[model samples]
Target: MEHKIKVAVNGYGVIGKRVADAVEAQEDMELVGVSDVTADYRVASAVAKGIPVYASTDEARQQMRAAGYPLVGGLSDLLGKVDVVVDCTPAGIGAANVDLYRSLGVKSVFQGGEKHSLTGHSFVAHANYKSTLGRDTTRVVSCNTTATVRTLTALQDAELLSKARGVLVRRATDPWESDHSGIMNTVVPEGRIPSHQGPDAQSVVPNLDVVTMAAKGAHTQNHLHFWTVELTRAAEAEEVLAALKAMPRIAFVKRSDGVVAVNSTVELMQDLGRPRGDMYEVAIWEDILTVQGNELFWTYTIDNQAIVTPENIDAIRALAGTVEDGAESIRRTDRALGVRADFTATD
Candidate 1:
């Protein structure tokens, strides 16, 4: 029998809950428990689902028990029981928890919010999965950086890419926080050249030559990116599309099919019955992809909430040394999560 890797999710917010669920879905992984600092409705939802919940602080333990939510123990208690801890806490908080995880002799995984230097390893399953095997810790690059690496690495693997530039239209905030936070009726630029995403992606695919600029849109839903790439040689649109299609998790949608914008993809995910309407794949507009000699232009949408969930699952397998081949690990994750390479049906 294959050993199921013991896992703990530290943080139960947007990314944390999703990563916890993904871990539970895998046949070769076991979700030991989840730890969070709050006793909010999110924690309640985890309890309702019968997921073991642990408080991260003494105060949180009191607050959770006071609020009638059961607790297993403090964060350290949970960490001691698991082999690896996926720290989904807010950006800086994950960095703060590193010492505790190390003190307990537990492997850890962090989200993109932390610097790559924190773990000295940034992971994108398709790009650098094997490199992370049996490592103590690694940070899964942010959703934008994940998508950037996935797409550009596809081109590079096909031996077609030279360099790339991109513009990201980011959602002002997460959908859940729309009422309390986020900008209204305003589109804000990122205020710098080569937004952090470019360098972040480079951290995973060290040889990638890419630069990015970003702006925050008024609405909160998904992020859209437009890219212009210098290919190694002139390629036809069909060739470029084939390269993208060859990559797993890169799904194609077409304007001709009425999939015209980011909203259309969101609606499509809901119609397809995805949990929380999550589109894990990067949805590229197949009809709009253009090729002019050595230059290629294309666009895609990123589901910030869900895209990295699978990568986190793969990272768990990598860190636990349960899976040796990166491709096999990715295949296992895609199967467990029902990740589809093609969203449309054909005769």
Candidate 2:
């Protein structure tokens, strides 16, 4: 029998709670502790779930007091208790903590953000599962990046496109407690947030270079992205649609009799019925793809935590040699979740 790998999650907000829950659900991973500099309902919720709550630092204590959490020591103490630390703090903080986690000899995973890049390698689970071998740190691409890569990898493998260009129109989540949801009636640019999706996915599937544009909005929920691509060959739009529609994690739904719009994709996520506050329930729609015109358009959602945690767990499993490859680890995880992926079956 294999001993379960102990795991700790620092920062118990939206992504942190989800990571902790994901760890608890895995049979090979155990949740050791939950830490936060500024505790709030999330920390209290973790306490309700029977997870240990540590004493925060003085600065953190004051924030916790305001947030209604009984503060704990600074983040350093969370270092010694687990093998992998998933840092879901604000962007700048995670990069700063990377050294601290390394000093403690613990493997860690990072979500994509501007200020930090703690990973030695990145794991897409589908495209680069093999990359996680013996890596001490890993980075899960951003939600937008995840969606784009999945599409780009599929299209490239089918030899449909040689180069890709896309535009992302993203939705902001409800602010930390703002009455006005982020996107009440607004559409904004993602503005140079460097989505490494295009280049990163190109590394695995081969034969494609990608460029992207991003737009952000005030809405606090999921996003609706539009991807316009220039295909290598002029194929029928239906054929291109057929190719994308065939993907497992991706679904192609029609919004109207002949029009593909962002709202159409939003409805798909609505049909998925994922937890209300969960970020992983994004659904995509291939609304407009003009093969004859050498262009394709689509929209999708992103469950940010879903993209990160599984890859992180798989990375640790790869390190432990519990699986021979990333595909096998992903397959094991799918089975655990009552899911089955034909695209990733091992021989």
Candidate 3:
């Protein structure tokens, strides 16, 4: 039998639970346990799934015990058993846990909320998977950044890109948190020009020339992006679509097919019976993609809650050296996560 990498997920919230599930699905990884500060339904769901639950702190342990939840041990105990820890805690919390991981000699993967200096490497599996192999830590860029890198790199790889500009219509909050968080009646523009996503994506593909602006929407389903790209030279729409199709995890949806809006794509995911209606692929509108001279225009949607899950899985393999070939690791992850090239067609 082959040795599997022991994995512990710290923070069983939005991204953590999904990471745990993805780790469990991988043939080359073992999910030792998960740690969280809360003993709410999220942690309870982990318990129901038979995942070992550990308290992130002494207080959390007591809370879980009082809530009648079973625990294998505390966070340190879980860390001692795992080869790697995926830190899906809120923005700055993961940064605080870095010292503990380093002390235990365990590899760590962080979400994009942390600064690039946290790990010095921001990951997009398709773009920079090889660079992370055997590295101690890495941050999987944010959902929007992941989508940007995935698509832009495809164009870059095909020699079709020169520079790009994008506008992101971000979801106000995760669907589950909409009741208590997010904007209600109005759309709010981000105060910063060239929002952080562009620079974050650049961390993965450093040569990428892109600028982005963003705004918060009244909805919570997913984020929508309108891109105006400058091709290296005049190209046909077919040429651009072919480049995008060459990339893995970049799927296509069409307005003509009634997948006209962000909400429709969410409905499509539920209809497709995806776990939690999660669409991991960046859905591009193929039919509407236009090319005029050296400029290209297109739109796509990002499932902020779920898009980065697969990248985190691939990052684990990269960090553990479990799979040396980035493409092979990606193939394994896409298979395990059920990421497909076409979401609209029955597979």
Candidate 4:
């Protein structure tokens, strides 16, 4: 209803950092400020951008000031100024902050790390964008769930997909955490089928028929998802690529170009001059796409850290009715943030 939604990002870590940047890029929203407990280069970066950085506690304010980050104000300053808060904190922190957000009479968005019951609306703008419309508090589905739901939603929108199964090769930690976050000496399995991702997707797409298993890989850069999405009818590989290509948030990798690994994909995005070195699309390897009867099988790398950034942006728009259509909001976010980051190489 207001001309622009004032948004504060509560955590400045991986997800929070990307969300802040994405929110700043949006034409219809304002980044009121960002809050973080950790005092590091990230906080320093925010200060350098002239973005107000807030500390939630006296100890945190002291730590940030000690680290030479100029403190504009404390957490209450951000909470008081903003219309809505995107709690980009670690897994459980957002859940804890719900009461605080409410006390301030602010709308909020949480990340997928929180339980679905954390809020009435669990959001994937491309999937359940309408569900979040006119809602106050919601959680942008996680990176993995976004990747899966984006694809599944596209297929379902076309009335093509009948069922789906995925084997998620998840990175143990994000790229920044790779130093301290232990690498998998060997692949670690979740030791169970029907990983939470399946249910997470279902939470957004009620009719999505998906089952997933997960394993942790040694590196922490991208998450590779191998999905077998069965369509209602047979289709060619080219048709599959076209279907995926037609989807807004999907970037079809036209060629392998000797780029076969997830790390190399990150390098490619970097070399292509991706903003913040972020890869916000599902980079589907089109050359490897296959079709057998009514099933389409493909592998795509989801930049686990950055792919969900735009979803948060769109979720914000949905909450504000800034864009009435979910697809339009997704398009605006993709265009602003450069989803897929580059398309000159695609055929």
User: Which sequence of candidate numbers ranks them by TM-score, best first?
Assistant: 3, 1, 4, 2
What CA root-mean-square deviation does each model show from the true structure?
A: 1.1, 4.8, 0.8, 1.9
Q: TM-score per candidate, in order?
A: 0.98, 0.79, 0.99, 0.95
Global lDDT of each candidate: 0.93, 0.62, 0.93, 0.84
| Location of the lowest summed lDDT over 10 successive residues in candidate 1 | 338-347
Quick one: RMSD of model 1?
Answer: 1.1
Q: What is candidate 2's CA lDDT for residue 248?
A: 36
lDDT preference between candidates 1 and 4, better one: 1
Model 3, 212-259: lDDT tens per residue? 999999998899999999999999999999999999999999988998
lDDT, candidate 1, 94-211, per-residue tens = 8888998998999999999999889999999999988998789999999999999999999999999999999999999998888899998889999999899999999999899999
Residue 52 lDDT, candidate 1, scale 0-100: 96
Q: Compute the lDDT of residue 234 as modeled in candidate 2.
A: 75
lDDT tens readout by residue for model 4, 1-347: 44888999999988988899889888889998998887777788888989889998798899988988878888888899988888988898789899888888888999999998989679887777887877889998888999999888777877788999999999988767767776668999897788999999988888889999999988877899998888999887776666676788787675647667787778878887877678888888877888999989889898988888888898888877767888888888877876752354552
Give the runs in model 4 whose Cα sits over 4 Å from its true position: 340-342
Local distance difference test, candidate 2: 0.62
lDDT of 4 at 121: 77
